[model samples]
Target chain A: MIVAIASGKGGTGKTTIATALARIWDGPRVAVDMDVEAPNLHLFLAPSYDGRKRAVLDVPVVLHPEACSGCGACSRLCAFKAIIALGDYPVVFPEMCHGCGGCLEVCRRGVLGAGKRELGEIFWGRAGAADGASPDLRIAGGQLRIGEAMSVPLIRQVRTKANEMLAEHPGDVIIDAPPGTSCPALSAVREVDVLLLVAEPTPFGLHDLGLAVRALASGRVPTGVVVNRAGLGDDCIRAFCHKHDLPILAEIPFRRDIAEACAQGIPLDHMGELRTMMETLARSLRELAEPRVAA
Target chain B: MSLIAVSAQGDTPEASVDPRFGRAKGFGLYDPSAQYWSYLSNDAAQAQAQGAGLAAVELLARAKVTVVLSGSIGPKAAVALRAAGIASVEGADGQTVRQAVAAHLEMPQRGDAKS
Candidate 1:
């Protein structure tokens, strides 16, 4: 089963919780950092280098400018305006293209050709086993190339690569998704069996968490909330979750020691209380994934 | 008769020039030969979430506009305007459309003899 850990607001400790869970997961597990724009899970997981590959998207380029009929059909048909048919030929902007191939299909003259645009890189390694010992967790994720506007494609690639890695070992997947309820975040959680939304208990956190909850209200996956910095703010998040009938799976309280450990790229598995809490969270997550197991 | 389009806050030449090119409220178009002014509402481009500049450029291109005067033009819009053979003059903000057009007219024309 695949579980995605997401948050509506940044700095809500998604990577902290994801790394904790992945380290202590009882069975074989793969942790995927889907926040390609700024992946920090690597700092915590410390996955040794295993494999890497460049991710690309196919965009159309003008192949034949000489056979010109400046009909502007391709420009008119393009919803993105990535290509514009000018005086004699269409100028192509690969950055703006969504790689939909609609222009090529519309071009009767076959003026457009398939072109590849580098989106990002997908790299995988094993975390917690740099000494050639059995790895405690498999790590896989993607990083968006700088100045790349579109991150959904890279996030999709990370998810796909994680799944491919899982096929080799057949393990549970834990995806640390990016913040917000936008396309990149939604793409990370898409089709997952369970989603654990990591939320802070502050007013801003409550508001953004509501946005995320509303965004996923129509989704079929079972969702539960894990309130981080639980005692630092009021119980508004708790009230909101209770009003919505959403279960509170766990809460990581506001503590300086935990913050220091996180800052040092240390997992909470070494802390007694936090480790027990993560173990309990693991049980709850497994139960959420398989109701029969809990029954 | 060349046409000039000024991104404007309102429909008339008396209105202030809109500072933005992509999300401008509207355009006040002037035909120099006819000395006539017209308004083109840019509601569609203003409402577009992405590629508003390109959409606005497409609108001007469709209207056969030869010159665009705006405060700022985004990179994509700049490219599209250059491709369409339309000249762009930036930093036209805070001025009335008529004043902006008058100032543009007073500027030295290309290929004119030096004083």
Candidate 2:
């Protein structure tokens, strides 16, 4: 099953929980970090990245201006208005273009051509035990190119690779999604079977969580909550979750030691409180992931 | 001489230009040769999701304005202005709408605005 760990607020311990779950997973699994703009899962996963592939976007570029009459048809058809007829050739803004390809279709003289730009790269690695044991977990994730306005394309690539691994691995695919309820966050959790909303117990966290839940209401994904740093705020989050009927799968209390270990790049494994919580989650996930028998 | 449109706070030549093009309160359309000015209310700027500058450009273009004096212009608005053969002039900030128009006329014409 595809499990996406997301947060409406950043720094809410998504990576902490996701990496811990990946470490304690008892079966074949692939953990992907979909926060391409600022990926940090490598610090926790400590995966050896042995392979990578560039992700490219096909944008509309102006070519063959000789065949064109400066009719401005393509520019008018563009939703982004990336295409514009200028003195000699129409100026094409590659950055603003979403690569929708309508300009090429609307060009009467075939003056428009397909151009490609690298959005990011997907790095695939293997996470091995600290003691030099054989790696059991496949780690795949991406990082968006600097100055690139879009992260959806890179996040989509990470998900694509994770889904491919799931087909072969027969295990859970946990996606460490980007924060907030924006397009990047939605892109990460779009096709997941289960989405873990990693939230902290604060008014702001709960506020954004409510907004995220409203956004996710339109999509078909089962969701659960994992309260990180659970003691900082009042029981408002608990009340909200209870009122919304969102299952509280786990609550990781505020721990200074865990934070220090994570900050120092130490794999936080077998920690008594967290391990028990992860174990319970793993069992519940196994049940959710199990294929239903034919009636 | 190119007709010009300046984002302005009021209808007269003494009114300072609004730096924000898309959200300007009003615009003053001027004919350089004739030294005449007229006002158009920018009622659409407040409610538009986007492309407010382009909409303002459309209004100016319809009035045969060949240059735009604004506090700022968006990328899409720049493209639209370029396509329509209209020049965008910056540094209009803190200048009156008429000063902005006169400034564009006084300076040596550049190929593009300083973004």
| Tens-digit lDDT track of model 2 for A206-266 | 9988987887534356678888888888887899999998888888887798777778766
TM-score of each: 0.93, 0.85
Top candidate on DockQ is 1
Q: Against the unseen true structure, what C-alpha lDDT does each candidate score?
A: 0.86, 0.77
Residues A1-295 of candidate 1: C-alpha lDDT, one tens digit per residue? 8888998888898999998888888778899999999998888888887999999988888899887588888898887878887657887788988778888888888788999999989999987655222355889988899999999888878888887877788888899999998889888888787889888989999998999898754446778899998899999899999998888999888999888878887787777698889889988888887852233
Residue A263 in model 2: shift from native, Å? 1.8
Superposition error at A77 for model 1 (Å): 3.0
Q: What is the docking quality class of candidate 1? A: medium
Instruction: Give the local distance difference test score of model 2.
Output: 0.77
